[model samples]
Target: MSDSSDGIAGIPHPNPLRRLTLDQLRRRTSVKWREYPEDVLPLWVAEMDVTLAEPVVRAVTDALALGDTGYPHGTGYAEALSGFAHRRWGWDGLAVARTKAVPDVMTGIVELMRLLTGPGDAVVVNSPVYPPFYPFLGDLDRRVVEAPLGPEGRLDLDAIEDAFHRETAGGRRTALLLCNPQNPTGTVHTAEELTAVAALADRYGARVVADEIHAPLTAPDATFVPYLSVPGGENGFSLMSASKGWNLAGLKAALAIAGPAAAADLARLPGEVVDGPSHLCVIAHTTALREGVDWLDALLAGLDENRRLLTKLLAERLPAVRYRPSQATYLAWLDCRDLGLGDDPAAAFLERGRVALNGGLPFGTGGAGHVRLNLATSPEILTEAVDRMATG
Candidate 1:
């Protein structure tokens, strides 16, 4: 909470995650705070426990002050995302001409899948992924195919290729709903791995639609490879947003970026779909990407510290529970099979520990015996959560 500047454009860059007290967080009405009872420490959802960056707040407030609530126009979101990608991931392949504004990452994925494949077609996903992939694709009447991650929680090329081969049989169209810097596990896919995936998709005539909303939250030690930047990935699509990185989820805006070869298909996105993002949200997301780097850096530092802290806390207090420090995002996937808890450890944690975490069951195959913990909170809360889990 110190006002001391950390030297980025003379803006103070203290750890945003640690700035707010538990009482302040409890006052929040967001789902992360309100999903459970008042006594429960909620850390299940993707929402971050941080204040908005100054530039983002200023942009949204100025727009509201001017009554600038209206339909979005122009390529500001794409342009801002392009600059952020280049600066953060060294990715310059985000072609502004091939980008479309979408409501959010999951919704964008749904629309993109609709464009790429039809009902009864297969949508291959790496299992133990974002739970929404199952239901969202199901809503489209697309068959959900699982290619579970490897033992280490990284993609399994063999499993992916096998699924690709099986799903593409009988001339059925397929699409791969990839999660770059995967949710829950936080394994940042490498360029080599993505290239291989692209090759498999190419071989099987399957399109790749990546949910890259978590792209910006990759740890300092890891590199996030935009799927479109890989060889044979020209037909891939990526959905990115500053919402996750800047804690702007309630604002709701994201970009659907298409590879060079997929531009034509993306152009076919319905006019109604293109009109989905909130104008105010576009301004907020754009400002965050364009001017909030210092704040994002401070947040990343704080999350990295929390990741390490969780490791120590689990090792000391709940050694039986296994947690692999994630390479991206604030979510931590913990293996609780060793703790003698049932398949849904999150259930026991919630009831006995008075803490909330995302259960692994709904994530599909390879999800049982695991739970996803949100590490975007303060160290004190994280430590206390672990202590409660230990006694529970």
Candidate 2:
């Protein structure tokens, strides 16, 4: 692969995913590497197979050297995110004052849901989504109502409206947990679609909490429309992080952004909740958003190539499997029903092919016979995975 210049001190930016070898990855103690045996090629989780960005590494090390391991303070993380949004997405509406620091996206979502709804209230989600949405809300005592995505893996606004009307009929409150640039399927929601969602939320008196963790991973050809940037979205909330884009999940830090109209609700967030993020992680995430742009661009380019490569490999080898190139994120949703595998094709892949993938059943409706493949790895590994699946 050719190097992309950052134009800063004439430095070249190479693909981060290609920086580490299989032997190096095997040494990793993270869940992605340790989940399966040495023979099984693991590609199930959202974790990326890449090295950390130089700036993020530098920032964290500098902080550690200075013993800056205390609690987080200041608006640096939020400010950096605002600048990133403006530069990358042309979104100038991420006000620093309306933002709060949280441990991660899911925790932020739970806290926001607490502010919006009480127990037994309904939480609407597009089905065949991130698996955690089901158990998380259920554990909170909030009913998980499904508005399955349309056949083409796009949002079904009609299903959403129906869910909203049905859930709110008994004077119960409802909240929509939107997955922007959806997980597994990787469909980036369009601006028109988000605007319609805001309108429907207004019609049904439902609050919208968007999980926009995958926003920065959108392919160059696609546009990621932030839910709070749309019409009638002033009451919505969003959670964003550099974890997915920069591969800093273990660091654990995210920002909770509230629309202008929802500022008061955000203010209700407890002080202890704001104290959850690791101070060192805030430094790392902030540095990633502010100075890791070039590295992120290179990673995106690598992911784009991997997605296309997967398409060609599947066509040539696993022709029975159907895969649509994702518009965003380094995840490819594969329809493996025709492969003669059961609802959980991942099980067959692991046992027979020695390649671990996430099964579709746990992702809720429309997920049977489907598998989610991680496309954020070296091209060689990805090609080998496809070859193994084909012969298995």
Candidate 3:
């Protein structure tokens, strides 16, 4: 192959609004079904239906060609992340000083448990969150203090503060785990919201771990505030990955960006604890951050269009299913209680409608009667899925 900047297709024009059709994405995944299973649509997982960006594919392929899938060792890995952080979100130099490589967001959360607190310690999580948050904490033998998020699908600062106060009164060590651009709700916390959280965490001597994996997909009307960029955020840790936004979960690369103090805590933990994907993941992660910006922009634009299309379709066709426009990411938080699905519309969709979606209860209590849809597919697929679901 002729030598090019990165052995990938040249960057396309910057059209953040560009997108591939759902049929194209479905064909690319080579999805298998028995006769397409009578109109079944798969939107259960967060996987995107798009092809891998050329730069990311080239990087991974090049690394594999080198024939050693050994452990990663590259200075540029962290630097690329830092550059992406600065360029994408204006958070500078953090990837160098505070970021540490990990296998994925789950590992980071588990590690935070080990690094920040002990068994019986209180960890506050707003309900209706990613399902893994519950088990990840449970497996650590830690006590969970749930601040039940309100009906509006927004975080309640008062409840969070009360949880912290109760924990403090009982003399237990406490920490807060924040899901930014929150999962299953698509509520992107504002700068003020983040600062309010930081204040609560700081006031009680508790640490905050902000999961910002979805920040990259912030839609046009939404604001994605990096938890660490907010005031009092210096005392917290931010966990992120290219996986969620770039369809790179298969790469298994994530980082934990910390403040000086939090970094010290993670550093003191033994190296043996970090078991993750190999050197190829490092190359993919770095390349995605450095040379994949144009592709990411395209992907996000596609996601925005998909979100809008879904909202309009539901409004016009499936009036029973209520949905709000997403501020960031391709996930749609749909309230299906009006359908009388009785707290598990996902199951109804899958069994009755032949459509696969994530049930809301997995996110938290308020998640009941809701379903989270992955809109990373083509618009046609989204429409078909909704059509089948509505008919059911």
Q: Which has the greatest lDDT?
A: 2
**TM-score against truth, every candidate:** 0.97, 0.97, 0.91
- Those runs of model 2 whose alpha carbons end farther than 4 Å from true positions after fitting are 1-11
Tens digits of per-residue lDDT, candidate 3, 2-57, equal: 21233245655333233455455455443332224535677877777776767888
Residue ranges of candidate 1 with Cα displaced over 4 Å:
1-12
The pairs that clash in candidate 2 are none
Clashes of each: 0, 0, 3
lDDT of each model, Cα atoms only? Answer: 0.90, 0.92, 0.79
Candidate 1 per-residue C-alpha lDDT over 1-392 given as tens digits, one digit per residue, 9 for 90 to 100:
32212235555588998889999999999888888898999989999889889888888899999999988999998998998888887889999999999898888899999989998999999989999899889999999999999998889999999998888889989999999989889999998999999999999899999999999898999988999999999989999999899999899999899999999999998988889998999998988888888888899999999999999999999899888899999999999998788899999999999999999999898889999999999999999999988887
Whole-model alpha-carbon lDDT for candidate 3: 0.79
lDDT of 2 by residue, 1-392 (tens): 22212325556578988988899999999999998899999888999999888888888999999999998889999999998998888999999999999999999999899889999999999978999988888888999999999999999999999999998897789999999989989999999999999999999899999999999999989999899999999999999999899999999999999999999999999988889999999999998888888899889999999988999999999999999999999999999999889899999999888999999999999999999999899998999899889888
Q: Tell me which residue pairs clash in candidate 1.
A: none
Q: Is candidate 1 or candidate 3 better by TM-score?
A: 1
The best-first sequence of candidates by lDDT reads 2, 1, 3
